[model samples]
Target: MASELHEAIFMAKQERHKNLFLNYRNLNNFPVELLKDEGMQFLERLFMKRNSLTTLPENLAQKIPNLIELYLHSNNIAIIPQAIGELVKLQSLDLSDNALQIICPEIGQLRSLRHLRLANNQLKFLPQELGDLRELETLDVSMNLLRTLPERLHQCVSLQCLTADRNLLHCLPRQLCLLPDLNELSMAANCLTSLPLDLGRSMELQFVFVDNNAHLKGLPSYLYNKVIGCSGCGLALQISDMKQLCLTLGDVTVPLPSEVKAIGSESERVLPLEELACRVLHAAYDWTCKDVKLRTPFLMPKSLLDVVQWPLGHCHRCSQPMFTIIYPKLFPLRETALAGVHRSTVSFVAYCCSSRCMSTFDLQA
Candidate 1:
């Protein structure tokens, strides 16, 4: 019955119409039990887009082996069949907006695939075998939860564009630079803290998308020439003895000497605020004196304070914040004078202005 229905449609196409449109005909849900193997032998293009298909018929490619393009977007598919590799003449495959969790390793066998779209899926990782699709030119896997990419991606020598934004990746595969034909690379909204040292060394790389990742610290030095937003000014170099280099770009903050996996313990790289202030002041001024500004609320050590501001409970006399008062400067002290009286390094200690009545009471006490 299904074969007769398809035959009738083709007969109609040949009788009165040179072209026909048969989209969204609810053909995906039918069980017409036709001799599909021989009927669809010459079928080259199939559009099953926007359906409720959870999986494709296993013998589909075997029947329509000459198929070149397939659109199966907007489905509930959780897995792609390994038999997809048999579509030797396929040039494009759209599997976007699906619930797919894994990419079949056999997909790499489609050497003739030029465009592949797997965006808006639940994939956490990609098969390294995809790098074998040397004829692939466009690949889009946006809006997924990928963490790390396979280094074998460099094998796609003919790949010219790759879009992988809105993922959880912390870093990129360094081997990406080996793709001499790559022109565009998008890696936005990831946990990236820094780029590989040789990222922009690729002369063919023309555009890059690295925004929306506020925790990202630095870009490769050579990338300055290609990046328009940085104005070619890459990570500023600073000399310091402390392991971490703290930099405040307006309200956002980032630390250098980025987190690295060493032995067993994970530690935060920290730099003293005094050293940071000295560097900032010395860079613009000709003065030989290395002056460290008195620390304030902004530079409060995270070790001592769990919150941002000093609470009134820490004060002895007043129920308000003491020490480190923010007033018109009468020459900020390099170190608080209260440092001599109280131990604990006197993080903050300021004397409240005494009133005439309070002074008389203080004399009596």
Candidate 2:
């Protein structure tokens, strides 16, 4: 095996091959022969999958400086040297199925990187500098020990697909909803109790998976049409748990109600002062419209402006802008038409601006 491996590398060097495949080589370390004598400068791609290699040489970039793709999947690699940042032209990197506990922040220097796979690792957290990869399109950090994702990841403007399934995430960064090009999101098997309200609001986002979240009883209405996997949710609901999921609008913080406040029509009820003010301000500011050509300079405080900018969410029934409060209506998945399709036990929560919409809103409709 050793002779065969050496022969392959020798042949590649003699021919100045642009691609090198050394998979299943039973190698325990990066072959020193490849890094000798100026290295294979012409090598553009390297495959070293399913190896016993534990670490990459610090001078790897100096030797194979032109590498565009590096595949080191299913290895025992525990650490990535900072020298990896020197691979400015690298476009794809796969460090999946490894023993990595931390990623060097210098990884941000890979300005040309488009895809990064770090699944099946022992990572506890990722660096904030990962957001610097403006060209990043796909990021997979599944099957790890991550408790939270970096909020700065929203800067990956070109990102389209993000997968963090089977992690310890409790909540996602709300800024992630601002990704303009993001289309698919998967967070199945996490400790998430609630999702960002703005999730799936983007037209580009078409698929969302949150299956097996036993504590999550409700999903934002925006994800109603896009949610593809949601089985094994709504198994438990506690009033104490709901209290922790409060929605803060401007200076007012409202706890998510565990049950419907009332069961009357709109005319039979008088709107709360806070709710009424929110509705009036929303209309005055034309908050529902995508474009606002204000005729005068708006002088509202930043706190109030934030409320108008980000409402609780649009009413699921009337599509009216909801702020300050929400009349939540829950529906069992088995009773709804989606039950047969998704096979989920999770109950869906529909948000309404008033009791009227809440009474009339139909999950089937």
On the 0 to 100 scale, the lDDT of residue 204 in model 2 is: 93
lDDT of 1 by residue, 200-311 (tens): 6788877666655545644564453453121111112433454765567455454532222221443422222332232233232323334324232134354233222222
lDDT of 2: 0.74
lDDT of candidate 2 over 252-338, digit per residue (tens): 454433222322544333433455455555555645555444522344664555555454445444455555333222233445564
Cα error, residue 100 of model 2, in Å, equals 0.4
Give candidate 2 regions above 4 Å deviation. Answer: 232-365
What shift in Å separates residue 3 of candidate 1 from its native position after superposition? 13
CA error at residue 77 for candidate 1, angstroms: 1.5
| Candidate 2 colliding pairs | none
Candidate number achieving the greatest TM-score relative to the actual structure: 2
Q: For each candidate, give its TM-score against the true structure.
A: 0.58, 0.66
lDDT of each: 0.59, 0.74
- Residue 140's C-alpha lDDT in candidate 2? 99
